[model samples]
Target: MWGRVRKSWSTVRDAFRTERDTGRQARSHNLFEAAAAYVSACAEDDQERIEEAAGWVSPEALSFGVNELACRAVIALARERDESPRAVARDLLGLPAA
Candidate 1:
Protein backbone atom coordinates (compact mmCIF):
# COMPACT_ATOMS: atom_id res chain seq x y z
CA MET A 1 0.00 0.00 0.00
CA TRP A 2 2.84 2.44 0.86
CA GLY A 3 4.54 1.60 -2.37
CA ARG A 4 1.41 2.45 -4.32
CA VAL A 5 1.08 5.77 -2.44
CA ARG A 6 4.70 6.60 -3.18
CA LYS A 7 4.24 5.89 -6.87
CA SER A 8 1.17 8.10 -6.99
CA TRP A 9 3.04 10.92 -5.31
CA SER A 10 5.89 10.54 -7.76
CA THR A 11 3.48 10.77 -10.64
CA VAL A 12 1.91 13.92 -9.23
CA ARG A 13 5.35 15.47 -8.67
CA ASP A 14 6.42 14.74 -12.23
CA ALA A 15 3.21 16.27 -13.57
CA PHE A 16 3.76 19.42 -11.51
CA ARG A 17 7.35 19.72 -12.72
CA THR A 18 6.22 19.40 -16.34
CA GLU A 19 3.57 22.04 -15.84
CA ARG A 20 6.10 24.42 -14.28
CA ASP A 21 8.56 23.94 -17.09
CA THR A 22 5.82 24.47 -19.68
CA GLY A 23 4.76 27.67 -18.00
CA ARG A 24 8.34 28.96 -18.08
CA GLN A 25 8.68 28.13 -21.77
CA ALA A 26 5.39 29.85 -22.54
CA ARG A 27 6.46 32.99 -20.74
CA SER A 28 9.77 33.09 -22.60
CA HIS A 29 7.99 32.59 -25.90
CA ASN A 30 5.56 35.37 -25.08
CA LEU A 31 8.47 37.71 -24.32
CA PHE A 32 10.16 36.84 -27.59
CA GLU A 33 6.93 37.48 -29.44
CA ALA A 34 6.72 40.87 -27.80
CA ALA A 35 10.28 41.57 -28.90
CA ALA A 36 9.42 40.56 -32.46
CA ALA A 37 6.51 42.98 -32.39
CA TYR A 38 8.87 45.70 -31.28
CA VAL A 39 11.26 44.91 -34.13
CA SER A 40 8.42 44.97 -36.64
CA ALA A 41 7.24 48.30 -35.33
CA CYS A 42 10.75 49.69 -35.67
CA ALA A 43 10.92 48.55 -39.28
CA GLU A 44 7.60 50.19 -39.98
CA ASP A 45 8.67 53.37 -38.13
CA ASP A 46 5.46 53.17 -36.17
CA GLN A 47 5.87 54.79 -32.79
CA GLU A 48 2.46 53.64 -31.57
CA ARG A 49 3.21 49.99 -32.22
CA ILE A 50 6.65 50.30 -30.66
CA GLU A 51 5.18 51.75 -27.50
CA GLU A 52 2.58 49.00 -27.40
CA ALA A 53 5.27 46.36 -27.67
CA ALA A 54 7.39 48.01 -25.02
CA GLY A 55 4.49 47.63 -22.63
CA TRP A 56 4.35 43.89 -23.29
CA VAL A 57 7.86 42.97 -22.11
CA SER A 58 10.57 44.21 -19.80
CA PRO A 59 12.97 46.74 -21.33
CA GLU A 60 15.99 44.46 -21.01
CA ALA A 61 14.23 41.54 -22.70
CA LEU A 62 13.00 43.80 -25.47
CA SER A 63 16.45 45.24 -26.02
CA PHE A 64 18.00 41.78 -26.22
CA GLY A 65 15.33 40.73 -28.69
CA VAL A 66 15.90 43.81 -30.81
CA ASN A 67 19.63 43.13 -30.95
CA GLU A 68 18.97 39.53 -31.93
CA LEU A 69 16.63 40.63 -34.73
CA ALA A 70 19.16 43.15 -35.99
CA CYS A 71 21.90 40.54 -36.14
CA ARG A 72 19.61 38.14 -38.04
CA ALA A 73 18.59 40.83 -40.50
CA VAL A 74 22.18 41.84 -41.13
CA ILE A 75 23.18 38.25 -41.77
CA ALA A 76 20.27 37.71 -44.18
CA LEU A 77 20.97 40.92 -46.08
CA ALA A 78 24.66 40.15 -46.27
CA ARG A 79 23.94 36.71 -47.74
CA GLU A 80 21.44 38.08 -50.24
CA ARG A 81 23.76 40.90 -51.33
CA ASP A 82 26.91 38.77 -51.25
CA GLU A 83 28.55 41.27 -48.92
CA SER A 84 29.97 41.08 -45.43
CA PRO A 85 27.58 41.38 -42.52
CA ARG A 86 29.48 44.42 -41.30
CA ALA A 87 28.91 46.15 -44.62
CA VAL A 88 25.25 45.29 -44.56
CA ALA A 89 24.86 46.63 -41.04
CA ARG A 90 26.80 49.82 -41.83
CA ASP A 91 24.73 50.45 -44.94
CA LEU A 92 21.49 49.93 -43.04
CA LEU A 93 22.60 52.52 -40.52
CA GLY A 94 23.62 55.02 -43.25
CA LEU A 95 27.25 54.83 -42.17
CA PRO A 96 30.08 55.48 -44.60
CA ALA A 97 30.83 52.43 -46.74
CA ALA A 98 34.07 50.59 -46.01
Candidate 2:
Protein backbone atom coordinates (compact mmCIF):
# COMPACT_ATOMS: atom_id res chain seq x y z
CA MET A 1 0.00 0.00 0.00
CA TRP A 2 2.78 2.38 0.96
CA GLY A 3 4.73 1.50 -2.14
CA ARG A 4 1.75 2.37 -4.28
CA VAL A 5 1.37 5.62 -2.41
CA ARG A 6 4.97 6.54 -3.06
CA LYS A 7 4.66 5.64 -6.72
CA SER A 8 1.56 7.77 -7.14
CA TRP A 9 3.20 10.68 -5.33
CA SER A 10 6.22 10.46 -7.58
CA THR A 11 4.00 10.41 -10.62
CA VAL A 12 2.36 13.61 -9.45
CA ARG A 13 5.74 15.15 -8.78
CA ASP A 14 6.91 14.32 -12.28
CA ALA A 15 3.79 15.72 -13.87
CA PHE A 16 4.10 18.90 -11.87
CA ARG A 17 7.67 19.29 -12.97
CA THR A 18 6.68 18.85 -16.56
CA GLU A 19 3.95 21.43 -16.24
CA ARG A 20 6.38 23.86 -14.69
CA ASP A 21 8.80 23.33 -17.53
CA THR A 22 6.05 24.06 -20.01
CA GLY A 23 5.45 27.48 -18.44
CA ARG A 24 1.85 26.75 -17.56
CA GLN A 25 0.07 28.67 -14.86
CA ALA A 26 0.21 26.93 -11.51
CA ARG A 27 -3.04 25.77 -9.97
CA SER A 28 -4.68 28.10 -7.44
CA HIS A 29 -5.69 25.37 -5.00
CA ASN A 30 -4.69 25.95 -1.40
CA LEU A 31 -3.17 23.29 0.83
CA PHE A 32 -6.48 22.50 2.49
CA GLU A 33 -8.23 22.11 -0.84
CA ALA A 34 -5.57 19.78 -2.11
CA ALA A 35 -5.64 17.81 1.11
CA ALA A 36 -9.41 17.44 1.13
CA ALA A 37 -9.61 16.47 -2.52
CA TYR A 38 -6.69 14.09 -2.32
CA VAL A 39 -8.02 12.30 0.74
CA SER A 40 -11.55 12.06 -0.62
CA ALA A 41 -10.24 10.78 -3.94
CA CYS A 42 -8.17 8.17 -2.16
CA ALA A 43 -11.19 7.06 -0.16
CA GLU A 44 -13.11 6.68 -3.42
CA ASP A 45 -10.14 5.00 -5.14
CA ASP A 46 -10.27 7.63 -7.86
CA GLN A 47 -6.83 7.73 -9.38
CA GLU A 48 -7.64 10.59 -11.76
CA ARG A 49 -8.88 12.78 -8.98
CA ILE A 50 -5.90 11.89 -6.86
CA GLU A 51 -3.53 12.97 -9.59
CA GLU A 52 -5.50 16.15 -10.17
CA ALA A 53 -5.39 17.02 -6.48
CA ALA A 54 -1.72 16.15 -6.27
CA GLY A 55 -1.01 18.59 -9.06
CA TRP A 56 -2.52 21.38 -7.01
CA VAL A 57 0.58 21.56 -4.82
CA SER A 58 4.12 20.34 -4.46
CA PRO A 59 4.62 16.80 -3.23
CA GLU A 60 6.10 17.96 0.08
CA ALA A 61 3.33 20.50 0.54
CA LEU A 62 0.67 17.93 -0.27
CA SER A 63 2.27 15.53 2.19
CA PHE A 64 2.22 18.11 4.95
CA GLY A 65 -1.38 18.93 4.18
CA VAL A 66 -2.37 15.27 4.25
CA ASN A 67 -0.56 14.75 7.55
CA GLU A 68 -2.38 17.71 9.02
CA LEU A 69 -5.70 16.34 7.80
CA ALA A 70 -5.00 12.95 9.37
CA CYS A 71 -4.03 14.50 12.68
CA ARG A 72 -7.15 16.63 12.77
CA ALA A 73 -9.31 13.65 11.83
CA VAL A 74 -7.81 11.54 14.61
CA ILE A 75 -8.33 14.30 17.12
CA ALA A 76 -11.95 14.71 16.11
CA LEU A 77 -12.59 10.99 16.32
CA ALA A 78 -10.88 10.82 19.71
CA ARG A 79 -13.07 13.61 21.00
CA GLU A 80 -16.22 11.97 19.64
CA ARG A 81 -15.34 8.60 21.16
CA ASP A 82 -13.82 10.01 24.34
CA GLU A 83 -10.66 8.09 23.56
CA SER A 84 -7.01 9.06 23.32
CA PRO A 85 -5.66 10.04 19.93
CA ARG A 86 -3.22 7.16 20.01
CA ALA A 87 -5.98 4.67 20.72
CA VAL A 88 -8.17 6.04 17.96
CA ALA A 89 -5.31 5.93 15.48
CA ARG A 90 -4.43 2.39 16.42
CA ASP A 91 -8.02 1.31 16.10
CA LEU A 92 -8.34 2.99 12.74
CA LEU A 93 -5.39 1.02 11.49
CA GLY A 94 -6.54 -2.22 13.13
CA LEU A 95 -3.32 -2.34 15.10
CA PRO A 96 -3.06 -4.28 18.37
CA ALA A 97 -3.12 -2.07 21.43
CA ALA A 98 0.20 -1.41 23.09
Candidate 3:
Protein backbone atom coordinates (compact mmCIF):
# COMPACT_ATOMS: atom_id res chain seq x y z
CA MET A 1 0.00 0.00 0.00
CA TRP A 2 2.79 2.43 0.95
CA GLY A 3 4.61 1.67 -2.30
CA ARG A 4 1.51 2.49 -4.35
CA VAL A 5 1.03 5.78 -2.52
CA ARG A 6 4.67 6.72 -3.15
CA LYS A 7 4.32 6.00 -6.84
CA SER A 8 1.16 8.07 -7.06
CA TRP A 9 2.83 11.00 -5.28
CA SER A 10 5.83 10.74 -7.56
CA THR A 11 3.62 10.91 -10.63
CA VAL A 12 1.78 13.93 -9.29
CA ARG A 13 5.06 15.65 -8.48
CA ASP A 14 6.35 15.12 -12.00
CA ALA A 15 3.12 16.42 -13.50
CA PHE A 16 3.34 19.59 -11.45
CA ARG A 17 6.94 20.07 -12.48
CA THR A 18 6.07 19.68 -16.12
CA GLU A 19 3.23 22.16 -15.83
CA ARG A 20 5.49 24.71 -14.17
CA ASP A 21 8.15 24.35 -16.83
CA THR A 22 5.60 24.64 -19.59
CA GLY A 23 4.18 27.81 -18.12
CA ARG A 24 7.64 29.33 -17.84
CA GLN A 25 8.49 28.49 -21.43
CA ALA A 26 5.22 29.86 -22.71
CA ARG A 27 5.73 33.06 -20.81
CA SER A 28 9.25 33.43 -22.21
CA HIS A 29 8.05 32.83 -25.75
CA ASN A 30 5.27 35.35 -25.40
CA LEU A 31 7.64 37.95 -24.06
CA PHE A 32 10.03 37.38 -26.94
CA GLU A 33 7.19 37.76 -29.40
CA ALA A 34 6.09 40.99 -27.82
CA ALA A 35 9.61 42.39 -27.80
CA ALA A 36 10.14 41.50 -31.42
CA ALA A 37 6.87 43.11 -32.36
CA TYR A 38 7.81 46.22 -30.49
CA VAL A 39 11.14 46.45 -32.30
CA SER A 40 9.59 45.93 -35.70
CA ALA A 41 6.94 48.52 -35.10
CA CYS A 42 9.46 51.05 -33.89
CA ALA A 43 11.88 50.44 -36.72
CA GLU A 44 9.28 51.17 -39.38
CA ASP A 45 8.82 54.68 -38.08
CA ASP A 46 11.07 57.75 -38.23
CA GLN A 47 13.23 59.25 -35.48
CA GLU A 48 10.33 61.40 -34.32
CA ARG A 49 8.92 58.28 -32.70
CA ILE A 50 11.99 57.44 -30.64
CA GLU A 51 10.77 59.07 -27.43
CA GLU A 52 7.52 57.22 -27.73
CA ALA A 53 9.13 53.77 -27.71
CA ALA A 54 10.40 54.16 -24.17
CA GLY A 55 6.85 53.71 -22.98
CA TRP A 56 6.06 50.93 -25.47
CA VAL A 57 8.58 48.59 -23.83
CA SER A 58 7.64 45.96 -21.26
CA PRO A 59 9.24 47.19 -18.07
CA GLU A 60 8.83 43.79 -16.38
CA ALA A 61 10.91 41.72 -18.80
CA LEU A 62 13.43 44.22 -20.12
CA SER A 63 13.99 46.64 -17.32
CA PHE A 64 15.57 50.05 -17.65
CA GLY A 65 18.89 48.30 -17.05
CA VAL A 66 18.58 46.12 -20.13
CA ASN A 67 17.35 49.06 -22.20
CA GLU A 68 20.29 51.18 -21.12
CA LEU A 69 22.71 48.35 -21.81
CA ALA A 70 21.20 47.76 -25.22
CA CYS A 71 21.54 51.43 -25.98
CA ARG A 72 25.23 51.33 -25.12
CA ALA A 73 25.59 48.29 -27.30
CA VAL A 74 24.11 50.22 -30.20
CA ILE A 75 26.50 53.05 -29.54
CA ALA A 76 29.39 50.64 -29.62
CA LEU A 77 28.21 49.17 -32.90
CA ALA A 78 28.00 52.66 -34.40
CA ARG A 79 31.66 53.29 -33.60
CA GLU A 80 32.05 55.94 -36.27
CA ARG A 81 28.71 57.67 -35.70
CA ASP A 82 29.53 59.09 -32.23
CA GLU A 83 25.89 58.97 -31.19
CA SER A 84 24.77 60.85 -28.08
CA PRO A 85 22.81 59.20 -25.26
CA ARG A 86 19.83 61.53 -25.53
CA ALA A 87 19.85 61.30 -29.31
CA VAL A 88 20.14 57.52 -29.29
CA ALA A 89 18.12 56.88 -26.13
CA ARG A 90 14.92 57.08 -28.13
CA ASP A 91 16.16 54.60 -30.72
CA LEU A 92 17.59 52.54 -27.87
CA LEU A 93 14.09 52.40 -26.51
CA GLY A 94 13.54 50.17 -29.60
CA LEU A 95 12.80 52.74 -32.30
CA PRO A 96 15.08 53.29 -35.25
CA ALA A 97 17.92 55.63 -34.37
CA ALA A 98 18.11 58.97 -36.11
How many steric overlaps are in each model, in order?
0, 0, 0
- Each model's C-alpha lDDT? 0.74, 0.85, 0.50
Which sections of candidate 2 miss by over 4 Å?
A: 1-27
On residues 1-98, what C-alpha lDDT tens digit does candidate 1 reach at each position? 99999999987544322221444553323456777898888889999989877766566666776788778889999999999999999998899998
Scanning candidate 3 in windows of ten residues, the lowest lDDT window is 14-23
Ranking 2 against 3 by lDDT, winner: 2
**lDDT, residue 82, model 3:** 76
Residue 88 of model 1, lDDT score: 91
lDDT of 3 at 94: 79
RMSD vs true structure, all candidates: 9.7, 9.5, 12.1
Q: Please, what's the RMSD in Å of model 2?
A: 9.5
Task: Tally clashing residue pairs in candidate 2.
Answer: 0
lDDT of 3 by residue, 1-98 (tens): 99999999987544322221344552222333334444655668644443333334344543443455466567775564676755665764676756
